[model samples]
Target: MVTVDHLVKDYGTLRAVDGVSFTINKGDILGFLGPNGAGKSTTMKMITGFLTPTSGTVTVDGLDVSKNPIEVKRQIGYLPESSAAYPEMTVVEFLTYVAEARGIRDPEELNSRLADVIVNCHLDSVKYRAIENLSKGYRQRVGVAQAIIHDPKVLILDEPTDGLDPNQKHEVRKLIQAMSKDKAIVLSTHILEEVEAICNRVIIIDQGKVLVDETPAEFKARIPGASIDEVFRDLTKGSALA
Candidate 1:
């Protein structure tokens, strides 16, 4: 459902993403792993049409992201590392605005989508509360809710469960898993166990390039009896240097 071909993103002389390539099919939840400044977010931004690639291309469901930004965006939902929203707006108000922005014009459709996201994200208790007053975990849930408000075909989530507590994290993981059957998901996270639990495939990148692309089992098998963290450190240790 999503194809990234030799994607590169350069900020002046500094290259943030270099020649990254990967494909995500429906039902695949790919764990995108990398350390800070590893270009994971840059690549995702390009794929979502938020940032134009310096070179190469990203295609979503057969539509080129650069050339068909609007259409491609319509097919994908994105959550940045930090979930930003109008702090002044209530949860329902914010979501109602997003639903309309996503082209749900009819009142019935808007209300239906709003209700679905509120329930799915477990925001019923805070539906009428202003976003500024919510806790970090609740804010993250609100972010996820907005992303999935239109029931997008592709989900690009950066640190999806960043601030959630253990129970909240489990709930979000379950929600992602439930949504995976019908969508191509690219989940960027630092939580290895989360990846092991929900991601079937994994891609580890560093210094703007992909280092490992394999199934979770294949990746774990690389270093027998070693945990995912140990194997990951072994693979990208060089980039850890200053």
Candidate 2:
């Protein structure tokens, strides 16, 4: 559902993303792992059409992100790193705005979509509360609800569980796993446990390039009997595995 070929993103002289290439198929949950300044977010932004690539191509469902940006965006549901919402708006109101922006016209469908997301994201308790009054976890759920309001074909999440407690994280992960059945979900995060819990495929990137792309088992096998963290360090730091 998503293809990125020879993608490069340069800010004048610095290349934040260099020669990155990958394909995410339908029903796949890809974990994009990278350390700070590893260009993970840069590549995501390019794929989402939020930022143009310096070189190469990205396509969502065969629509070139750069050539058919609007169509590409229409196929994608993006949850950015930060939750950007009108603090004063109630959860329902904010999601209604998102539905309108996504060109959802049917009031019945909109209401149904809103209800589905609110329930899926466990927002029923505060569905009528002001967004600013919700906790950080709830706010993040609100962000995700807005992103998926249109029921896009692909979901791109950047640090989806950044601030949640263990239980909340598990709930969010469950929601993502449920969503992956019919949508291609690509997420960038530093948490290895998150990958282990929800990802079927893992791509480890560093220094603006893809270092390894493999299934969770193969990734762990790189450092036999070692944890995911150990494998991550070995691959990213150019160290010899034990």
Candidate 3:
């Protein structure tokens, strides 16, 4: 389980995140929704221990993130918003580097893992292509493949389906759903229907605060016939966040 208690982050005079708290249990897929610059990425970063909370604590399965960063990171896999990668390296080279960095030292084991990821992510055709030479959709797939090469217990994905076609999005969603049975997954997305389609629970935040946290059915049930976007606007239109 991932437990966040009273989390906060500040940038000079601006508060990027303020007193946010939530728990994501195993086998849960939590969809984090917020407007642009509303601190969705910041919260995810803090949860994955990429950024420290200014005040509160984040604990993953009982290990405090700040106190045991390495251990916490060992159990989690993160895909950042930028999908950062070694642009100079081919997909094969890049994934190999990632698998090694993840401590898969046995050559045979590494190759076996790579083979599975290539097929799982449908990267067989582009596996030999340079990351910089791949299309945006292919690059996104490469990013995802690297994040899951080690198959950590927790998954943090920021815009996991960004820049994908309809088919690509469906493929990624299925991968997530299949993985959700074992891992605690947190995904931040601007796509409302995507959340409704896959996420069992949803969180809507604005102005660095959580305005809604409930099941997708309950969230929509708040106003009969209203879409997720309508509920989001109603809850988040109160103030400009960020």
Candidate 4:
């Protein structure tokens, strides 16, 4: 449901994303892997219409993100790495604002959506608390909740389970797996185990370019008996060796 063709993002002389291309179909959860500042988020921002690409294109369901940003945005939900939110607003209040901003005006729909995210993100216990008062895990959950509040067909999550206990991480993985049956999901994560567990396909990038794109098995097979970390290191070993 999403296609990125030759996407490039440049800031002056520095190129952050270069010729990145991929397609995500329904039921496909693509594991976007990269090291720090590897342009994963930059590519995602372009896909979500948050940042205009220096060149190339991101299209969602036949709508060009650059040409029809608003419409394309309606088809995608994005959770950036930081999960920034209005610190002073309570969870309910912040979500209310998000719903309104998303143009979800029907009161019934708003309430239902709110309930769905609260449950999905396991935020029922802290739904009434102010965002600033939340712990990092709760804040991450809140970020997730807001992203899915609209239930867009495409989910782009960066570090979706960044701050949480192991149990919480597993719960989030289950949530993602459940959601993947109907949506096209792209999640950038450092946790290889999470990717192996939840993602159907994997795409690894480095130095602003895609280095490997394969299924988990396909990738693992390249380095027989190696863990994902080992194979990953092997694939991107040049920079480290340099």
Candidate 5:
């Protein structure tokens, strides 16, 4: 459902993403792994039409991201790294605003979508509380809730379970897995265990380029008797971590 072809992003003289190409089909949950400043977020931004690419192309369901930005964005649900939200708004209020912004004008539809995401993200307890009053984990859930509120065809998540507790992380992973059957997901994360738990495919990028693209099992098979972290370090040892 998503295709990235030779995507490149440059900021002045610095090349953030270089000739990165990948395709994600329905039911594919791609674990986008890289060290600090590895171009993962930059590539995602270009794909989501948040940033213009210096070269190459990104398409969502046959619509070019740059050429048909609004239509393409309509098909994508993006949860950026910061998970920025209005701290003053209550959970329900914030989500309602987002739902309307995404074009859910019908009151019945808006309420139904709101209800679905609240239950799915386990935010029922804090639905009426202001966002600033919630814990980091709960706030993160709110971010996920807003992203899925529109139920877009593609999900691009950065550090999806960043501040969640172990149980909360597991719950989020299960939710991602349950939604994968109908959507193309790009999940960027540092935790290898999270990838092994929920991602069917892994793509490791470094220094603005893709280094390894394969299944998690296949990636581990490359270095037998080694932990995932050990393998990751071995693969990226030469590149300076930003």
Candidate 6:
């Protein structure tokens, strides 16, 4: 449901993302892997229509992200690396604002969506609490709740599990996995175990280019017996100096 073609993003002379291309089909959970500054986030921003690429194209559900940004956005839910919230707003109030902003006018549907996301993301305890008063994990859940509030066909998550404890991480992973049953998900994270647990496919990138795009099992098979960490090191070895 997502396709990126020859995508390139240049910052002056630096090519943050160079000719990176990939496609994610329906119900596929793609694990986007790369070291710091490896263009994973750059590619995601382009796909989500958050950042415009210097060249090439990104399409979501056949809609060109550049040409039809609003339509593309309407079909995709995005959770960036860091959660942005109104510190003073309660969880319910924050979500209400998001729903309104997304033009969700059906009061019944909005209420149902709010309840489902709050329960699914385990935000009931803080449902009435101000966002600034909640812990980091709860705040992250709020961010995710807002993203999926519209029930988009695609979900783009950047570092979704960042800063969470093991239990919280597991819960969030389960949520993502469940959501992927009907929606295409592209998630970028440094956590290999998270990928192994939730992602159906893996795409490893280096220096803004795709190095390996394969199923998780096929990715593991490449090293004959090595762990994902080992495979990653082998693929990215000497890349920094190149």
TM-scores of the candidates are 0.98, 0.96, 0.97, 0.96, 0.98, 0.97
Residues 1-242, model 5: lDDT tens digits: 99999999989999999999999999999999988989999999999999999999999999999999999999999999899999999999999999999999899999999999999999999999999999999999999999999999999999989999999999999999999999999999878888888999999999999999999999888899887777888999976542
Q: lDDT tens string, model 1, 1-242?
A: 99999999999999999899999999999999988889999999999999999999999999999999999989999999998899999999999999999999999999999998899899999999999999999999999999999999999999999999999999999999999999999999989888899999999989999989999999999999999988998888866621
lDDT for position 13 in model 6: 98
lDDT of 3 by residue, 133-236 (tens): 99999999998998899989999999889999999999999999999999999989878899999999998878788888899999999888999888777777
Residue 148 alpha-carbon offset, candidate 3, angstroms: 0.5
What is the C-alpha lDDT profile of model 4 across 1-242, one tens digit per residue?
99999999999999999999989999999999977778888999999999999999999999999999999989888999998899999999999999999999899999999989998899999988999999999999998888889989999999999989999999999999999899999999988888889888999889999988899999899989999888888877765421
Ten contiguous residues with the weakest lDDT in model 5 = 233-242
- Ranked by TM-score, the better of candidates 5 and 6 is 5
Write down the lDDT that model 3 would get: 0.91
Q: Write the per-residue lDDT of candidate 2 for residues 126-224, one digit (tens) a residue.
A: 999999999999999998898899999999999898878899899989999998999999988868889988999999888899988999999999878
Residue 45 displacement (Å), model 6: 0.5
Provide the clash count, candidate 6.
0
Candidate 3 has which clashing residue pairs, if any? none
- Quote the positional error of residue 23 for candidate 6 in Å: 0.4
Better of 4 and 5 by lDDT: 5
